[model samples]
Target: MGYAQVNGVRLYYEVSGSGRPLVLLHGGFGSTESFAALRPALLARRRLVAVDLPGHGRTADADRPLRYETMADDVAALVGQLDLGETDLLGYSLGGAVALRLAIQHPRLLRRLVLVSTPFRRRGWYPAVLAAMAAQDERTGERMRGTPAHETYARIAPRPQDWPRLWARSGELMRREYDWSAEVAALTVPTLLVFADADSIPVGHAAEFFGLLGGGHRDGGWDGADRPASRLAVLPGLTHYDILDAPALPAAVLPFLTHPVREPT
Candidate 1:
């Protein structure tokens, strides 16, 4: 475990393996520990930096509400602090959103981008769950019981006490809207979009996001010329929650991270 003080926030991060740097950003309700299963596989080929975003794991909470753009700035500051120039980034769900923002605001800092199960638009369910949890309500948890978020929380969250605060922080972050489609369309780094076949976010939505990637033709209204080199892969038989358990998940991602970026055909 390691800690870096960035913008008055003590960010908790873990490092493993060696080679080109690869930062892992976990989803909401998840900390650096969430990447444990895939870390070893990735570590073999590159250095892995896994961090707990604010309000998760060992990172201290912010004095104000959490926003995705703010979180992206925090990541940008951390990368500069660590002196990791043009490193690869792998972000899951909420983390993916932050990664997209970073790619837009600070494109020079990233060499490649990987997004897992992230939606282009903020979903209503996320805020609804957050509002309920903020009021100390259990209904959202009850509703999420058999869902991917619940299963993911069961695996990554440290304890019961840790959940509410994280949920509250996530709520604050969700309140801030982002133009993900536009930001992603403007990205210049190589990108790999991964989604589970049975993802709760809907395959159509994921496809919509993929279609936005400016690769020769812009299908989602953004300039295709500004689109970065990209690829999209959907894991078969995997649910939003079970994607982490997919044997081919890490394998599918590793090559994309290590390979050189290709020009749009």
Candidate 2:
């Protein structure tokens, strides 16, 4: 566990196990602890570099707002600082957005990308989820007191008093408008899109996201030789909130990261 000075912010990250590195990013309001339950299986086969994104966990928020693009740049800088060369990148929720941007904006740094519960566009989230994000403000922190997100922040943040600010900034970032279909369609890195059957976004949107990666448009031939380089997995019996804790997360991830690409005969 250590800190890397990158993009004008001190980013905290923890490295565990041993093998090829897989940078793990957590959802908004979450920390490295977000994947605590899911890391064991992954650790056995791959090194886990779990990052505490800016304004989350040990890292404090900077003067700037918490925009996904800026956060992506921060992560890219962290990769450069660590000299990780080409490595796998995985992000959940907010971290997923950052991971998406980095893979699009700095593809050279990554060998593969895994995005869990991520939406390509803002409208990809259900209307109710959008309303919840839009409702967040400084006062939201008070309402969130004692909740897991709040409790974790209070326990580890450099300044627990900054919860309200973090809440507001995260809300602001989420509420902003965005659509990256063009960029997604242009992606070259092998990608995996994971979502729950009952995710924050519709299953159809998940299909849409996979489509952007050139998946699901055709049937995989016998032996799966006719599929796109990218893949999708919609795990059963889960939701956006609890998907991280599900063992199925690492279960779906390991094969994608470890399996070699097969060319059509």
Candidate 3:
């Protein structure tokens, strides 16, 4: 457990276990500790490098605005600094956005990727989810006071007083709009999109995103030959907030990351 100076932020990350490295990036308002439920399974299989993004977790915020592209660059810098060749990456929610950006901006850096409850486009989130997006402002931070995410931030953050700034900035970042449909279709890295059956994004968008990755388009022959390198997983009876903690999450994810996908010659 140490810090890597990446893109002007003292990025805090931890490495554990043995075997192929799998970098874990958490969702918004969360830190490396967010993976507590899923950690054992992931650590048992791969070298886990769980990191706290710029503002969340143990890492302190930089003077720059919170943006996925820069956050992705921070992760890229960390990966390069560690010299983790062809590593696997997994990100949830906000982390997923950063991971997706990293995969797009630096495809050669990843062998495989697992995106948990993430969307390629801002509209991918449900309308109600977008409603909550617009609802954020200065007062929004106080509204989050005493909540679990806020409480967690208050405990581990380098500057606990940054809680309000964190919330306001998170809202600002979430409010920014961009779409990567064309870029996603051009992505070469294998990815697994994991979404809860009852997620913040409409279930149909999952299929749409999967399709962009060249999945859900064709049938495998009798020998199961027509499958795409990328895959999709929808865990039952779970929502966006709880999907990462579900036992079935690793069940659906690990195999895709651990084994080789059969790419046709």
Ranking by lDDT: 3, 2, 1
lDDT of candidate model 1 versus the reference? 0.74
Give the C-alpha lDDT of model 3. Answer: 0.92
Candidate number that wins on lDDT, 1 or 2: 2
Computed on alpha carbons, the lDDT of every model, listed in order, comes to: 0.74, 0.91, 0.92
Task: Look at candidate 3 and give me any clashing residue pairs.
Answer: none
**Candidate 1 residues 1-265, lDDT tens each?**
6778887778888878889999899887677877878887888899988888887766767676777777888888989988888899989987988888888888899888898888777651245443553454234445456555556555554454445555556655666555567776666678888988877567777767777875435452454445447878889988767777577899799878776666555
Could you report the Cα RMSD, in angstroms, for every candidate shown? 5.2, 1.5, 1.0
Candidate 2 on 232-256: residue-level lDDT in tens?
9999999999999998998899999
- For model 3, state the Cα shift of residue 245 in Å: 0.8
**Over the stretch 115-228, how does candidate 3's per-residue lDDT look in tens digits?**
999999999999999979867866888888999998889899999988888878988998989999999999888899999999998889999999999988899678767888
Q: How close is candidate 1 to the true structure, as a TM-score?
A: 0.81
Error of 2 at 212 (Å): 1.0
